[model samples]
Target chain A: MRGVVTLHADGLSKDFGERSALRDVSFEVSEGERVAVIGPNGAGKTTLLSLLAGLQRATAGTVSRPPEEIGWVPQQAALYRRLSIRENLRLFARLERVADPDAAVDRALELTGLADRAKDELSTLSGGNQQRVNIAIGLLADPPVLLLDEPSSSLDPRQRAVLWDFIDGLAAGGTAVIFATHEIDEAQRHADRILVLGDGELIFTGTAAELHAAGGDDDLVVAFVRVLEAQGH
Target chain B: MRWLLLKDLQILRRSPLLIGLLVVYPVVISLLIGFALSRGPDKPKIAFVNEVPELQQTINVGGDQIDIASYSDRLFERVDPVPAATREEALQMVEDGEVLGALIIPEDAGRKLQTAVALGGSAEKPTVEVLYDASGPLQGQLVESLVDSTLAEANVAIGERITEVSAGYLNILLDGGSFSLLGQDFDILGLAEAERILGRQAAQLPAGSTERAELERIRRFAELAVENLDFSDEILSSISNPIDVKETPVGSSGGTTLESFAVSASVVFSLMFVCVLLAAGMLALEREEHAYGRLVRGLVSRGKLLAEKVLLAALCALPVGLVMLVVVALLADLDWGRAPLWTVGVLATGLAFGALGVAIGAVAREVRAASLLAFGLSLPIAFLALVPAGTVADPLYEVIRVVSAAFPFKPSLLAMDAALNETGDMWPSVLHLLGLTAAYGVLARVALRRFG
Candidate 1:
């Protein structure tokens, strides 16, 4: 909130017909901040990201960000199945109206380490490679902020480590990154600050150390399990 | 934009069903139309009954003179000639389907002509009856005309012979009154004298002037002759007009061959409009897949993404349209003289339709709903192309005409036809297609705002 805020959301809320998905949710991520948004399946972590990404309009809230300032990688890999890896990158570059699409695509492919398989169709790529392509698409416009949802969900441990390292490098380069994941260990490893949601409301906001010290009795996951057990889960 | 276009092109290349439909449809249509237009004859059996030997002789002579055998060979593969024992038998043959038709010469026909000639007057014409199955009008008419032509020639010949004999008898009566030949001629003269005496006795009773009666009779006879001649000429003209409008292929550019090819080409290209629906569905799928959310987060505006999808669909539609055009050209033997014009027209039409499809698809949330709506809207538009310009006289067709004029494919068809046949105004159709393209573009843009 102090540094030049990359994203600022105040009193953000969403309603679908009769059901409210989120209610007056507000948060801000400063420049180069690595934030992890964690919640149970229906706790509206996805909705928050969607609102932040400008995919859905808030019922009442204010979101301030420059156009094309955020790079989003969806939970599911959004790679075009019919297009080759390079072609998919090129399509995003062209759509973004990048002046030199070929160079932009080449750079993105190199960043994602998918340069070697540029000519291969997306369908032929493994789930991990496809995820990399999706990430590459988000990186094509070279936006200052990256928003990823469950980016490591489909990858193996090795692939996940590679992705975490990539995100760490991006953060080091002063690109703010916010990702949503259920994996507490991965979040603790990469995230500078962690935000937790429970039943459509933000329950916790602090660093991993603070969260662990507060729990005291066990780790973050163990604490969550004990809390669920107390509720007769 | 180029990348989006290239990606779509790659997808189109892999679709085998699309390729086959694009290439084969026009060729099949062309072959069907060609087969229908080819001249082929029908074979029908004919039976005849000739009670008078002279009548049969006249028919044989007339048939030989007209080259009936050669004509029949060219017209029909089989010409069965059955001789009936009696007039009733000939008629029965026709009823029983033993033959298509039968011609009967009356038994007293020759005797009646001879008596009328002896009396120094026009002959009582022998009546020839033609029996035919009413179920087959064309065949019945053909057989009837053939027989009638033969009878007409015989009548003309008999008329000339009777006129000569009457003239000779009159001269003999006028110059040589008392001779051996007089007995033969005077025997008929006695009956004429008796008939004259009876006419004079009847005329004594006052009714009207003889001159008036004679004038009225002459007028009636003249009217009857004119009516008969006109009727005969009308029938003959109708017969001649059969198959008169032979559609010769105008250097492979005109006639039913090209017309059918154009129709198939139009249909094939029209289907390319479905690509718009596919593009629309792709957009919907993106929303379902949460890709839109990702793009939004990536700072891609809704409008830009929608624009990109529309552009992609239009780009895809171009080659699909071209593939259809190429297929038609190769398979249907489409004349290449106007290929450039057709290609341009088809491309414009394809873009308009593609845009329209995207618009429709955008409104529906799922592929099933989008497909149903797209297909429903396009079916009526496609149907409009089937109605021939000359035959579209109904009020509903006029409405369809107005609506279809607003679609690029219809105008493209109109332009193509005009280019190939030079039958309609091409400029108006071109303008119409342009207007449709603009309208579709506007609609697509509007749809993006409403449903994007």
Candidate 2:
């Protein structure tokens, strides 16, 4: 994977009504980098991903990236379920203004191993296949940055491994992947850098080894607890 | 854009429930509306308590009398005239709901008219009182309307009687020179029976009496009046209508009874499109599935997404509109002409509903919400349109009409009315529908873009 800078977020913050969801959150994702936003429920993991995905604008900071170049995969698979997998891919490709929509969809189907089920209604697919189709639609644009929210939340262990492998392949091809997930172990294994947020504040940002070193804990779970404890969460 | 649009079509084709509704409802509901309005209500109930039996006597013209009962008989033809023993009995029947209303004629009505005519037709015309039961307000209003119309006809009848009396007086004075006796029939003389008695009056007068002198004076005056009688075209117009309306109504009476109903029925059918079901649920479905966020971040702009959805819905609505047009025309002998005008109206109507659907999609945020809104929006437009076209011009309907103009269905319905009526000027209505459709489109776009 190429080591080219793709996305830069500085001092990102978000608030909903009187409650703050994120504060002083900043991160840079280079080409081929996989960043995981990990936090307990209501700790602003989804909020941060939403902000980076451009689904929601930050309350107090700037995100610098090429316009219309980010591919976002929502937790529930945001494509139309009534539409066939191929149709969904084709629609997303068209939206991205891909030079050749047919080719883009075909490549996405191949990458996700969804070529056989491309013509099937998304609702008819198993959860694993549907999730793969979701990732495939996100890949249709060949975007430099991809944001996913809980892509494996509904997947079994084997399905989750299969999805992670496909996502890893995309990152290998110079794609910057940022995802939000509740699974701290998965983040430790797959993420190049883990962002641990507690009570709307980013308390730790580093690889699993570095996080363990900083927290004086060997296990990634203990390291996560230590990080949150240090932040007084 | 193509892919996005095709997906909607694909969904429509694949969803059995949706396909069934779109294909079947247009025909079934159109027929239902057509049937419901085609026969409309039964004959309005009326009780006639005609106490003036003496009014049945004939009116005398130059000693020839004509009966007044003949003219009044036509008034009762439009109602289901109920039978009752007396005026009080008729009133009770109305209260009991046996009849909608009653017309109570006074016993002295004939005597008054006769005595008034005897004194040169100068007395005021006797009036008939109307009594009605007010229960079932709508039905009550209907009965009242029927009674009012009947009364108008009766007034015309009275006017004819007065005209006859004056013409009879002229007959007496002219002594049948050119004046025709209104009541007496003569085979060879054309009402010249009055002139045959002229010499008898001369012989009956006493020699050198004052009565003879007065008879001579009247005869001389009558002679001069008959000699100077005007038969020009202007004066002859009284034989026909003195103020002939010349009709020129908005379309050929909107065809026979069935045809007129079609205009309103088709309108109602067209209105049932997306605003009835899909518009209410569209955005709600999107939010429920959480697809809105993905689509916004992906290919299409928010504006484009909304526009595309509206376009799809409008496309779906077109066939339904066409079905309404065809079904109504078939049943009612309705004139569905000015193809260009109808085409534009149908398209705009479809788009407007589509826009409404987009708005619904945004606000409902749930399937049930969509259904409720569709039901909510549909009934009002449909109700306003459900009435017969003839009643639309009634002052009672003015409120509905004004409110209906801002809606897509009403304008399209009215445009079709102009076309069916052959009133020749339908563009104003067409423009109204298009303008409304555009407004709905703009509103839906704004809403979905902001909220979706």
Candidate 3:
């Protein structure tokens, strides 16, 4: 709690027409904290990530953070096919008006382990490399907070492991890491705290041990199921 | 901004065909029109047969010389004339393929004139029997008028000589008052009225040396009248006169040809600007892939993203516009003085159109839709701008004027026209271009807020 508060969302809610995508959600993650938000499809996990990322305005609450302080890795990587890896990074750096772009780009590529493949076009790169470039683009400015929205959604198990290791390294380096995923097991392995969301509301927010102890002899998935059952998901 | 511009340049380098079409087509058309069609005089040919001596004299008086040497040369090479051995021969020639028409003068033309004089009434008309090929009736009519004018001048001259002699003999008995010639039915009498009046005035003068002063006055009057006779001729000549339009620049020294070249170049660049903006497909691709979500999470404000795209589009459009401007100027032999004005106008137009393309692309949901929408909107606008403002007409013209006022290319065209021809003020065109650019800027901002 003494660490710098990277993100502080209080009573965060979003609505599309009459349907509530996120309802009165509150969460906080400090520097060096790794929080995994897990939920079934349409349970507002992505919506909460969007809200925290400042991608969308919360209809009913305040989500505050430092300006230009968030780095995001989207679920699909979203690399430009027309651009080379280096060119894409260069464009992002230029658009963001990053100071000393050459060094920033080098650091991003080095961090993502894509320094050697920078010359290749994005279309020619493998899905995993492209995802790494996407993450590299996000990391170019060296922001204090990092948000990954199912960053490993389309990767193979090997690719996912590589991505997970990259995320772990960032969290270990004092960057506040917040990832949203449908993969409960992966979240259990990497998350310092797991927040379970059901029906547009948070059902559990504690360590995996506490979650398991509260619902005995059950996997984190079963425990989440019990929590959902109690909450009538 | 630099990196984004460089990226667009690289893309343009990769796609050479699109760039070539965008920049070359307008230049080619301009060169073709400026050099090839902008020459030569509007010459229309008329064919005639010379029969009466007076008719032949009138033909010589007019500037059009008879082209009678070779039938092929006369008819096919613009100056048409046909020849014949006799009056009947000429009529037959006209009926055949040899001539436009024939003018048949009566064999006893002088004798018929004498008979008319002796009888003191009009004699049988010395007919100018005109014959023509079945191709056109108008050509035959024109030939008739030519013969009629020749005969009319002859009759007037004969009448004028007779009246002069009579007036000289009668002036001694006349009182000094304005006298009107009464019942003078002879064509020669009417023609000689001016000379008869002069003769009568001379006779009425006293028989002394003062007659010399009267003679001097009469001589001066005749000279003045002759000079005044050319007034109708001057008016006629001025009516169909040609003017040489020349262009010069206030800021630079160059030739008029450079201004034309700049217009060509500007058109090429305008097209390229529209094409690249349409082809970039950045926003549509992002929306299609749902990557807007990613961009938002990266702390990229929508305003920043819009600015980035506009910067990229300007980067793409400016150089291509310059390249086209230079190439066209060189090829079209355009005046160099107007080059700066043309360059600025073309580049600004390109930027505005580029922004519009991006804004339209952002509204579209897919790349195909974006391309279709951008192209569909720009094609008509480009065509409207391409048409000369002077030639525009009707409701369509008004509509085009309003639409083109907002379209980037329109102001560029007007600016090029002014620069090339030195015909209008450059400031209005500059203001129009800026207004269009600002309008596009606002539209792009709205699009970014709603869709980016």
Candidate 4:
């Protein structure tokens, strides 16, 4: 069961010059709810996440969550490669004005299960570990809403499982989770509510069973393709 | 802000190569500038062609003989003057680039000089022709300067000799020989004889006659006028020391001390390499790592982000600048006037350059490109800032002056120079620096927006 709404976007629209990236996208997320923004390439999933994370501004409409109350983890590691994981966390914690940066860094380390590798520089870490540090940076302030853009794009199966488990714990703790992903299986398995976007327009929004029923197909990838085709993408 | 500063410092501390470069850059620049100013230019080899051996002469001035040959010999101290057998040989040597320049004394020069000296007026002055290898312009100019200076000394010696010789002859004539007055030549012996004869005639005329009184008055007047005509000492004194010269400078200090020059050079080097390059490189590094957007999303404001980077650069640069000053002080006599003002100048310089570097890094996509841009910008700015006024042609120097002043380098240098040398007003530089800092700060913020 979903709790009270923690994030709300109403009539969000974004345009890049003459081309529209997102068109009147609307969504709502309640506490502890896991939402997946699944789309084809150039389908405005990242654009929507950026708008919600306050990394970019929407041309129209609004996001109810204040930017300070949001945690944005981009596709790239984006953390300082020369700095250690603890240093990176502490820096972001201080930047976000956390009450206690060291405590926040420690908690982020414990949450990501990267406390043992806290002293290792980002460059020396494996891709998965580096990505954990990236997520750790986003989790420093312990915000109410977390937005991840293709968080597991480059991870192996084992690393992907570990990242999902960590994110699952956060969502279970009432942190509203919104993620953009290309992997259909991960979205169907992990997300409680899935939003399908095709060519900058939201074509479907429901649980996996509802989407499967609507597409007249049991397979999630097949249903996703049918949804995109129906939207003329 | 502290976290932002610490992050950059921690990165720098890990990179030993970067730290080494930061320490080395300013020290090396200071030493190089110190050595360059302390020493004079190398002596250039020149060919000397004396067409007339007769002109190898000497003139007597106040009983001291000054040899014209010795003047050329004195030039050898500043240049390697090789003897060429003929004017053609000297020209060939110059064309072959065997020497920097050639000095040729024409065959008729000796005769012309003699005639001019003897006539005491209205004679064609002898000229010595110089043919320099213009291919190497700087060396050619040095050769010209060395030869010209020697010849000037020789001319002064000759002129004084001529005046002394003329005065000696005048005194001899005024004392006991025939002297000319109002275009009429008169022998003193004849004048004395006439005076004696007239006195006897006047005495034989009458004791109280009008003719006797008139002849006596005329003889007395002539005697007094002859005594006054022998004032040669006054004329000699007037001839020797004509037109006294006293130099007064328009600015505060007599001139910029060598120490002050080195201080300015060291500070400018630190600004370009330590402040500007480091700031640009760090910002570009973030862009390269793709962390710029993350920071933008997390930080309070983009303006604060840029300000931290600028402040980081300046704080890092301060110690490096001081190290450069210490090295300069060791190498030269450094006078750091008023500690507070010097510190302000250095800090302002760092801020101005740091802002500029941030602006550059914001536009550059990566660290290598930012470094290249910094290099391209710094060389010309350093050259323009350090190049002394009047070193080039008037029009080109004016252009450089205006262009350099428009940027922060010259003003930073001027401020530091004023503090070190205690010359010129530093307030103008301070104002200019503040204005530049604000302008570059705005530029960096705007570029970062596009970058983000």
Q: Please list the C-alpha lDDT of all candidates, in the order they appear.
A: 0.63, 0.68, 0.62, 0.75
Report lDDT (Cα) of residue B296, candidate 3. Answer: 56
lDDT tens per residue, model 3, B294-368: 665544766566656666666665666667667766786556787787666655555566667666765665776
What TM-score quantifies how close candidate 3 is to the native fold? 0.60
What i-RMS does each candidate reach, in Å?
Answer: 3.1, 2.1, 2.8, 1.5
**Candidate 3 per-residue C-alpha lDDT over A1-233 given as tens digits, one digit per residue, 9 for 90 to 100:** 43778788899888988998888988888888899999888999888887777777789988778436788777876667877778888878875578988888888888878778888888888888888888888777887888888888888999999988998998889988888988888888999888888878988888888788765646988887877887889
lDDT per residue for candidate 2 within B1-452, as digits (tens), equals 99999999998888654555567656755764565455443455677777877634555534546565665576677776777779879877766556666777667666665555555444554556676654222334555567666666655565565556566455544544334445555533312343334435855888788877776666566555565542322232232211111111112222323345356445646555554465546667767777777766635576776677677766766676667767766765655455556566566666666676776666555787567656655665656654432232234344455657767666655565555555446677777766775776677677665655
Looking at model 2 chain A, report the run of 10 residues with the lowest lDDT sum.
A65-74
lDDT preference between candidates 2 and 3, better one: 2
lDDT of model number 1: 0.63
Please report the TM-score between candidate 4 and the true structure: 0.68
Query: In candidate 3, which residue ranges exceed 4 Å CA deviation?
Result: A1-5, A90-100, A213-217, B1-301, B385-396
Strongest candidate by DockQ: 4
lDDT of 1 at B8: 83
Off-target runs (Cα >4 Å) in candidate 1 are A1-4, A97-107, A212-217, A222-233, B1-344, B363-377, B384-409, B442-452
When just chain B is superposed on the true chain B, each candidate scores a TM-score of: 0.42, 0.46, 0.42, 0.50
lDDT tens digits, residue span A1-233, model 4: 67899999999999999999999989899998999999989999999998898889889989997778898889999988889989999988988889999999999898888899899888999999888889888888888999999999989999999999999999999999999999999999999999999888988999998889878799989988887787788
Find the candidate with the highest TM-score and give its number: 4
1 against 2, candidate with superior lDDT: 2
Instruction: Flag clash pairs in model 4.
Output: none
